[model samples]
Target: MKACNERRVCVTGATGYIGSWLVRSLLQQGYHVHATARDPGKAQRMLSTIEGIDRLQIFRADLNEDRSFDEALKGCVGLFHVAALMEFGTSVQENDHVRRNILEPAVWGTRNLLQSCMRSGTVKRVVFTSSISTITAKDEKGDWKPVVDESSVTPASLVWKTKNPGWVYVLSKLVTEEEAFKFAKENGIDLVSIIPPTVAGSFLTPTVPSSLQVLLSPVTGDPKLYPVLVSVHSRLGSIALVHIEDICRAHIFLFETSRAAGRYLCSAGSCTLPQIMDIVSLELPNWISKSSKVEFNRSAPSIISSKRLLDLGYRFKYDAKDVIKESIQSSIGNGFLNSQVEFKV
Candidate 1:
């Protein structure tokens, strides 16, 4: 594989929570970044977050449009394909909506983007942001202890059969990732995948990302909104988590390291529902009226190994406590939470 032009790269979904932070980090490293978004006008507003706006270029592109990414991908040596649809609401008619909104965009969009990359010829390496859903999509039954790592994969049939909106989202990720790897292999493109669990951090956009919403559920008093969290807790006492900054660093590390190949599981640690609730109760006692103590299903698998990334000599900067604390502080600072709320810790 040819060496990437270290100075230039393209990041899809550049205005999203993780994408925006990745763009900023790339810019801070003195790289000229070409960012793609569905609405270029909306993306341009991100200039307020990063200092080197002059080095950033915004392109108008849609995931459904096959040729929309051509212009943005031109002359880019590295590509970070991070864009995907995030549908939150659940209704009786949500299955069709999920198929149209989440599945098509995630799978088809990845195909179209890789096609564009193959045509561009300038792209030597691609870093794809996948999810842990691809690993743990099996039905929650029996005493099953699955060894999860880069080799683990969720069955497509299981993802397709489930009516649960959360599982549907997982299905979307599973399909997209499988298709991406197949395409990359056929075309002889160097590809690396980052599979993260619940990503928690501050938001770059005005709205909060879905992952952060899980952490904010108790305080926001809308636990039903996070069905994924409920499902994960019911099965696996706690879920693996990683900070946004740490995930972004992993992306950069994988891209820059020649030996980096295959998928790497990115997680700082796991947090139980009670541990999270206790932190919330200690920090913002007046915010919620419910008891801080919550029971967890201890039998479910909660551990996610980051040994592959650790072998690369990369160290995580935040743990479960730091992730929750920093996320709450950021939410409060950004006015996502009530200003009157007090946080003692």
Candidate 2:
């Protein structure tokens, strides 16, 4: 296998959750990393999280803007497009904001970025931090399809997709993947979509999305949660879960393995919300109320296949429960949470 060591890599959203981890992992693997954040100053915030300080260089890039990515992508050998607007909540004033946050950046910014990559001739390939959400779509009769895989899943209309609150992030993911594929096809870019399911894990680095909310999940009705994740309080079902480190390794694995192409699903296992709570209950019973309803509402009927990764010899350090539990414990250890779970929601 060819390691991307000595490779000059560019990661958008380099200061964010997945992007931060990706940056750190690349640095550890000996890749010279150039990362982008909307503000170079805020990019410093990520320094506390990354393990390797000497290998990372922060540059300014915003999805909403056009010209900044050129310099960041100039010398990089590969691109990891991880930035996306994942805001939730419903206010009429910010409706277009949410839509454009993802659409403009993904559709427009990504196009220009890919063009720059080809023009620079330094980019050999691009690994997009895409989601399984792209698999969602509406049927011709106006029915809903939440299933995502190597098949066609039409997203809700671009406008409604952003405002769903629970799953708006997927809207951007769908659009991002669509645009990547379109751009790849038109300009001949080698692009791979990383489809991860319910990521949970020990936070080797500080990341916003890799928080307890992700571990506790079943979050209050907000736009950030994916629609496919709507199940709460019910019966036997599961949400595919993978540790954050495992997700990061998957990103690196895909980049190294020549066979890795198209869409690869990164998953550990699935567990019901109650099952999840049960695991956490042993550690933090105080957080989940005994009266809380832990039912399965919108869990997928099928489990995602990680056989591709397994065949490629990828190993997960934690299973679903252990990963979720560790995330909670890590948060507590990091002072993000106390040992006692006082969670009310």
Candidate 3:
């Protein structure tokens, strides 16, 4: 439980949605930050989101390139490994392409980064941003376990056999986290992995993240896209939701707290997709018309517990309703969504 403000820290994917916010938080806490971006020119645009630019150093590092992060890791006491390959439109037919693009980069990029950290000999702790997909592949029906925690994990063999794009992405995360833990253990690095559910909040970057894009699909009146949204809702059942800011705080908490170990599940609560649609409709009723068919599965929803984080005395600042409202407001402010109707929660 020592103050990390005296040490220098590095954040990979520093311009990304969650990563950008994390950089802002760390700078505000008076930490000297070494941030990495694949393209320094493009990353400059997002630099305005974080203050104290004088204390921030930017490095050019690509996750796919081995040893690209060596300079960034130099003299850093902590590392936040948040970069991952996430292609939104991967087809089942492109199995090999998916493996090469998404799976390999996620696993190998983590290995390369950890190797650099170990070589530098300055890194004492690593906070990895992992997904809840590693815990559960997909929602199941008919008398199954209704809760998922840190102990829950999807088997790699089972995920590989399905050959589904979504499952493949899950497998990539599973491998990355598992490999990261193994490397950290052997190298004596203090590693804390954060498993977060569907993250929804304001975007710090110019482009909308794939997760937010899916959440905003119903608002875009595309007939072809509506059923896909409905299908996702039916298949996923109840989703564990968390705000981006909360997840960033959880990462910082784990880094600063001495007792924090192993994995922590970060989520505010669970809510059905139809319930989310209802909230959205209240704000933008014109976005979702009465003619749109909303479907819900008649099965019990699964719950994801954040008791470990709670037990560690970390309080969530936003609930499911708050997440939706803030996201809509942010979208409007960012000009991602055009609506004349004012929305107040």
User: Which prediction has the highest TM-score against the true structure?
Assistant: 1
Question: After superposition, which runs of candidate 2 have C-alpha atoms over 4 Å from their true positions?
Answer: 1-6, 48-51, 92-102, 136-148, 152-154, 157-164, 204-211, 218-237, 288-294, 297-300, 343-345
Using all chains and alpha carbons, the TM-scores for the candidates as numbered come to 0.89, 0.81, 0.88
Clash pairs, candidate 1, are none
Better of 1 and 2 by TM-score: 1
lDDT of 3 by residue, 1-345 (tens): 322334699999987888888888888888889989998776777885567888888899997788899888888889998887555345555667767867777778888999998877778889998987776624343233567688877667766776444566677789899999998899788999998877788867887666666566666544443444444444346666789889888989999888999999998986676677778888776663432666664433666789999999999999978887888878778777774233343
Mind giving the per-residue lDDT tens digits that candidate 2 earns over 1-345? 233334788888876777777788888888888888887787777565667777788998776566668778776768888876655433444557856654665688778777767776677788888764554334455443444245545445643634443355556677767888889989888888787766655554453363345445442222233233442111113566777778888888887777877877776876766566567667765564423343453444554566767777888877887777777776677665543345755
lDDT of each: 0.77, 0.65, 0.76
The sequence of per-residue lDDT tens digits that candidate 1 reaches over residues 128-182 is 9998767752334534334446655666665566555467666777888888999
Q: Model 2 residue 252 lDDT?
A: 80
For every candidate in turn, the CA RMSD to the true structure comes to: 3.2, 4.8, 3.9
Off by over 4 Å in 3: 1-5, 92-97, 137-142, 221-236, 289-294, 297-300, 339-345
Sorted on lDDT, highest at the top, how do the candidates line up?
1, 3, 2
Q: Give the count of colliding residue pairs in each prediction.
A: 0, 15, 0
After superposing candidate 1 on the true structure, give the runs of residues whose Cα lies further than 4 Å from its correct spot: 1-4, 92-102, 137-141, 144-147, 289-294, 298-301, 339-345
